[model samples]
Target chain A: MQTKRMTFSSRWLPYALLAPQVLITVVFFIWPASQALWQSMLRQDAFGLRTTFVWFRNFERLFDNPLYLASMKTTAIFAISTTLLAMSLSLLFAVMVNRMLRSREWYTTFLVWPYAVAPAIAGVLWWFMFNTSVGIVPYMLEGFGYDWNHRLDGNDAMILVVLAAAWKQISYNFLFFLAGLQSIPQSLLEAAAIDGAGRTKRFWTIVFPLLSPTTFFLMVVNVVYAMFDTFGVIHATTEGGPAQATNILVYNVFRDGFVNGNLGASAAQSVVLMGIVVVLTVVQFRFIERRVNY
Target chain B: MVENDRFGSLLAHLILILGVAAVVFPVYVAVIASTHAPGTFLQGVMPLLPGSHAIENYRTVIFEGRAQAGAPPIGLMLWNSFVMAMMIAVGKIAISLLSAFAIVYFRFRFRIFFFWVIFLTLMLPVEVRIVPTYAVVANLGLLNSYAGLSIPLIASATATFLFRQFFMTVPEEMLEAARVDGAGPMKFFKDILLPLSITNIAAMFVIMFIYGWNQYLWPLLVTNDERYYTVVMGIQRMVTGGDSEPLWHLVMATVVMAALPPILVILFMQRLFVKGLVETEK
Candidate 1:
């Protein structure tokens, strides 16, 4: 909210400067979002001819519908699992890499490039590796007498999508964790070591606790990511298939809106997603404000 | 130094090696897969090592796309992706810089309103409001065009906030000095601000370029025409477009190409990428 004290008093120039961003936001972002809210309340007849304004009908039916409810539960699970898997793995890698003296940058270079790979591409790569027919993972799993088929088995499909999603996210989480780990003062750890703490003990007592702020921040980010951004991960590989096992909310919004052409229902879903995003954004900004104070 | 635990250092190296291998495994497999002939993927587990047909497979995908799958050649899709990425990156940065400068340097009417409007965009990612947004673009007849591919995605709150944050850190003396020198706001911005912001701009360019290149669903929705198909979305089409199992060799080749540019960007400009990413979060 703060601006420079010595400010320029401009009439048309500031307005002109702000025009392009404001125009795009209103036309592309705000107007469409408002339309989504409006349309969520209106339902069209099967023939696509007559439309009726049904108050809360779409949202009511969505909650009552078993599939929508299942999709909500599926999204919760997928988001949580992906966040945990990605954060923990990256935390471990960050911790290990943080300890290295000579090879730290080398290891980081190897781990961080995957952040550049598209989620959809990441999904495809994993899908190929776990391909039911000839994928390497399935072949390796077959050695343990486990039949790996994502097409038919819902659990297999969920696991496959999670791996793909988590795999793509690891690099992002790794970078943040590395930065966070690097920021921690070495003096504290050395003090703990002087108290006869073992490395494991020191990590639990000193390192992990110190990294909590970063952990909490990454948790929110990874959750938002798994919820929204992993649309590609689901779309490219699973297509919300095997009885909609991996159909996260964002993908469902896309499938219901664009693919199935259920406008009212999809609009309602979009509104719901917007509400979730609003909450998440508020939480993120609130945490950021708190961090700034710290 | 902490306790000199030789065993601990050894364990750290061992763990890091495994972690690196795990991180690189999928792409390594993709590269190895791209090198093989089509027949190699049909019968058994994917081979771990590189194959002899790398050139042929890369050539096939780059030049001659699988017509049956309806995917365009990789060469064209890669160009499309590059153009889209550049537009989104440069457009977002330019507009954001202007708007941030406006907000920071000038006290105008409805300034807070405009800041909040830009802030609202963070909550409305394309995924949430895809249907209505697509309708708006379609109404404007932007479908299957580069403008459609990038413009809708270019209005960025993160970039604006980044510039705003950076602008606040800039010493006020620069502005006062320029004002005393009779240089107007625009002149001062172009002369002083832009030069000072080059590093932040470069860092943001790295991040946004990757974000734009990695886009999948938006491109998938707007472009039914093959000409506008980006490599990221094009890979999805190659996998699911054909009835028969995808030509793994060529598909993997395209995958390598699609993921290469952004990966190389990060590898080469890692410091900038990290700075952009970490600062954007802040």
Candidate 2:
């Protein structure tokens, strides 16, 4: 908050430094975002190449489309299930690693390895493991005479996608949670133990509350990631196929825009997705900001 | 601590070991699978040890022309990915460093507004902007060009935000001393700031490189021709272009080869990766 009076030369310096970034952001980021907004309100003309202003007609059509409606539902389910699963597994793993006095580094390194793999590759790996013919798990299941079809069943596909996402994300959340866990003072835990509180009570009363801020932060990140960044997995694994069982909002946007060339519809879907993310983020911050203590 | 406390500690270790195994087993399987022959891999036999066929698989993916025989050349795809990743990495780091330095070191009007604008971009994922982004790329006539893939992603708000945060923690005395020594802004940054920020820069570079390398949808959408495909894009083409049985061996082989660079980087600089994440969280 300290004001440093700047000479004319120095005053222009920061702007000069910011010139490249501003230019790129405007040309790429801001321009694209605005273009998407503009496309959402327009309708394609007879040639399919020309466009006319429709003024919310695309949004209306989106509402009427059953596939779009189903995708919205699928997105919510995917986001919530993946977020919850990733958060819980991350916390459990973080706690396990934090409690270890020896071999902690090895455990920590092993935990973070999954985060390095590309999402596309992760999807491919999971696809192989879940494939009915070549997959080891499916082979073993069939050996026992049980039928399994992840690609065909909607619920099974959702679970598989969520599991794939949660597996990749656990490392990212675990790193943050482990850092948070280490930062908590040990004397408090020692005092809790000296008071004869059992491990569960001590954890609930002392550790859990102390770790709430990290949990809340990870929750916001994990949810956003589940919603937006899981597109690669969904695209590679399902292609939103088997009756669009795995078509989340982002994947739907990709399919509609590039695959189907319904630019207007895709833009409308994107705006809707952006609105949902913004609202969820705002609600999360409002709820958690008050509870987070420095 | 009591004997019961020691017992609880042992139990915690047991749990941690099991968790580590769960996290690592899949990767282990993938690595072992990479070394097995095509028939063995397809049959789903357990290869508990590394086979002698890793070189064969690598040769098949990289030079033997087995991964995607008729698609874009594998060598060309690797070159494309490497060049694109390097360009984006350099561009992201330079822009981020400059913007961060401007925000943190220099006095500027509308600083907070600029900061917020950059930070807000982080929330808007690429999916939300892909339609317009595709339009912009098409408009620029950059479609299928390396510039088209690299330029849009170069201005990373996340990198700028991170560098700004890191820059703010540097002591003011260092800057004042550099100024007193008759160094200009550029000179001060080159001599003082850049050297001191090596670790942070390296961390950001690795992260941005991985990000650029791993990008799928943007490249897939923006580039129509197979010639411009990155490694991930190439892998996707392999998976989808076939009507015959899914070539698990070739697919996994390509995957393992694609994953090699990042995995090696992670192995050597594992500490830096952990530190970067911790710093970001703070």
Candidate 3:
């Protein structure tokens, strides 16, 4: 809410400056979001002939439907697994890269370009690598007398999508983790080392605690990303198939509304997603506000 | 150093090497796949080494797209992707810059309200509100055009917030001096503020260009016309070609081409990309 001390006294210029952004927000963002909320309460009969106002029935039906509940469970598993897998590996990489004096830039350069690959492209790459016939990973798995086919196995499909999603996200989490590692005061670590604390003890007792704020922030971001931004990963590789094994909530929304024409259900699902996003955004911003003190 | 730890240093180096290999393995496989002939994928495991058909595969995809896959030429799709990314990056920056300037430098009514309105955008991502938003765009008849590709996506709260944060650190003396010289508001903004913000803008450009280029769903939703297909979405079409297994070589070639631009952008402007990325989250 702060502004410059000496400000411009303009009646029209400020409004003019704000007009374009406000216009686009209202037209493209606000109006559509409000419509989704409103449409979640309305139902259309088969053939789109009769429209009936049914308040909360759509939401109630969504809760009762087993598939919706199943999709919710699928989403939670995907988001949590992806977040953990991406964060832990990135943290390891960041710690190792942080130890280097001369080769840090080279290692970082090698690690960070994958952040630029789109989620859909990342999915395609991994899908090809795990393709049943030509995939190297499956071929290696066969050496251990194990079969790998995401097309038929639900667990295999989930693992495939998680690996794809987490793969694309590692570079982002790495950069953040590296930045967080760099920001920790070296004097504190040195003091711990001088206190007869070994490297392992020094890291757990000093460095890891200092990195908690960054970890929490990245957790919220990774969850949000795994939930919403992964539509492309699902769409491109799986299309939420193998008996809807990989159908997360956002993909469910698109599939129900666009592909299956279940408008009210999809809209209801969208509202639920918006609620999740609001909670996550609030958590993220609150953590950010508290981050200054740390 | 506190202690000589040659063993620990060696362990760190070994872990980093393995980590880097894990990270590069997928893309390495993709590049290897792109170089092989189409028949190389039909009978056995994908080849680990590059083949002589690299130029042939790249040329076939770039110049003549696989008609069986319903994909247009990669060259046209790449052009569309570039145009869309540029428009989105430039448009978001322009509008957000003006709005952030207004919020920082001018006293206005409903300022807090407008700020909150813009902030709400951070929560409602395009995926959650996909249906209604698509309806709005379709209602406005913007389905298959450049404007449809970028304009609806141009209003960015992140850029606005970043610029506002940058503006707060500017010394108040600059504005006071500009006023003493009788410079108007727009003039001061153009001459002084814009110059001061060049580095931030360039950093933001790197981030936003990558962001805009990597978009898949928005482009897929808006453009059904082959003339407007972006390379990212076009790759999906190639992979999902009806019934038969996709032509792995050409598909990998298209994938490589699709992912190259933004990767090059980040590599070339890594410092700015890192700065923009770390600061924007705050």
Candidate 4:
């Protein structure tokens, strides 16, 4: 909310500057969002002949529907697991890289470039690696007396999607974690070490507590990411498949709207998605405001 | 206690090395697969070593495409992705720069109002309102056009905030000096503010370009025509081709090519990319 101390006394120019951004926001973001809100209340027949305004009917049906509940459950599991996997791995690497003296740049570069791989492409790479028949991972798994077939097994499909989603996300989490690790003062660790605390003890007592804010931020982001952004991963690899095992809410909305032609239901789902994003955004900004003090 | 312990250093190195290998393993597999004969994948486990088909597979995919899947040539798709990324990066930066400048320097009425309106975009991502956004684009007849591919994505609240934050840190004397020299606002911005922001702009460009290039669902939804297909979404078509197992060699080749540009951007401008990413979030 801060502005310049010295001001430019321009009247018409400010309006001209803001016009294009305002125009795009209204048309592309605000307009569509309001449309989704309105359409969620109206249902049209298959023939597009009869339309009825049934307020909250789509939402009611969605909650009552088993598949929607399952999708929500799947999203929860996927989000939590992806966050844990991506964050923990990144933190491990970040901590280790933090300890290095010479090879930090090389290791960081190797880990970070994966951030550039598109979610769908990352999914394809992982999918090919776990592709029951020809996949290297599955072949390796089978050697351990365990069968790995994402094609038919729902659990396997979920695991595959999670792995792919986590793979794509690791670089992002790694960067943040690396930055977080680098920002931690060495004096604190030295202080702890001089106090007779071991390396592991220093991490748990000092390093982790200091890194909490970064960890919390990454958690929210990774959850939002697993919920929305991983649509590409699911679509490209599993298609939320093997019996809706990996069906997340965003994918369901796309399916309901385009593939199923249930526009009203899809609009309702979009509204629900909007509500979630609003809540998440609120959490993020509020946390950031508090973080300023910390 | 302050000793430089060799055992601890060795352990750290080993973990980092293993971590690096795990990160690179999948892409390594993809690269190796891209090099193999199409017939190799049909026989059991994918071959571990690079084969002799790398040139042929990349050539076929880039020039010819897999017609059966209705995917366009990789050369064309790559061009579309590049154009889309460039337009999005430039357009977002331009609009955001102007808007941020207005909000920061000028004491206009509804300045706070305009700031909140722009910030409204930060809450709702495109995915949350996909159906209606699609309808908006379709109504404007933007489907299958380059404009459709890029324009809907160019409005960026993040860039506006980033520039606004950076501009606030600029010393007020620069502006007072510019005005004392009889330079108009536009001239001052071009002369003083613009050059000052070159590094910030470059950093933003790297981040936004990757974001633009990696867009999968938007391009998938808006463009049905093969002529407009981006390589990221186009990969889905190549992999899901019919039934008889995707031609792994070319498919992996397509994957490599589709991911190459953004990967190259990150590798080259990593410092800028990391700076943009962290600062924008902050």
TM-score of each: 0.99, 0.93, 0.99, 0.99
Best candidate according to lDDT: 3
What CAPRI grade goes to candidate 2? medium
Residues A188-226, model 1: lDDT tens digits: 988888889988998898889988889989999999999
Query: Residue-wise lDDT of candidate 2 within B1-282, one digit each (tens)?
Result: 322567777787787778788777666667777787777755553455777788876777776554344455467777888888889989999988998888877766887777766766665778888888877789889999999999888888778867777777778777777677878888978888899889988887777777778888888887778679888877887777768655566667777777777777777888877766666544
CAPRI class assigned to model 3: high
Point out where model 3 deviates above 4 Å: none
User: Interface root mean square deviation for model 1, in Å?
Assistant: 0.9
Q: Between which residue pairs do clashes occur in model 3?
A: none
lDDT of 3: 0.93
Model 1, runs deviating above 4 Å = B67-69
Q: How well is candidate 3 docked (DockQ)?
A: 0.91
Pick out the ten consecutive residues of candidate 3 chain B with the lowest summed lDDT.
B64-73
| Candidate 4 CA-lDDT value | 0.91
Per-residue lDDT over B1-282 for candidate 1, one digit per residue giving the tens place of the 0 to 100 score = 576778888988898888888888989999999999888977778889899999988888889886534677889999999999999999999999999999999998899999999999999999999999999999999999999999999999999999999999999999999999999989999999999999999999999999999999899999998888999999988899758888888889999999999999999999999999999998
Task: For residues B52-112, write the lDDT of model 4, one tens digit per residue.
Answer: 9899888989998855434678899999999999999999999999999999988888889
Instruction: Give candidate 4 regions above 4 Å deviation.
Output: B67-70
TM-score (0 to 1) of chain B for each candidate: 0.98, 0.87, 0.98, 0.98
Per-residue alpha-carbon lDDT of model 2 for A65-106, expressed as tens digits? 999899888988988999898888888878877777677888
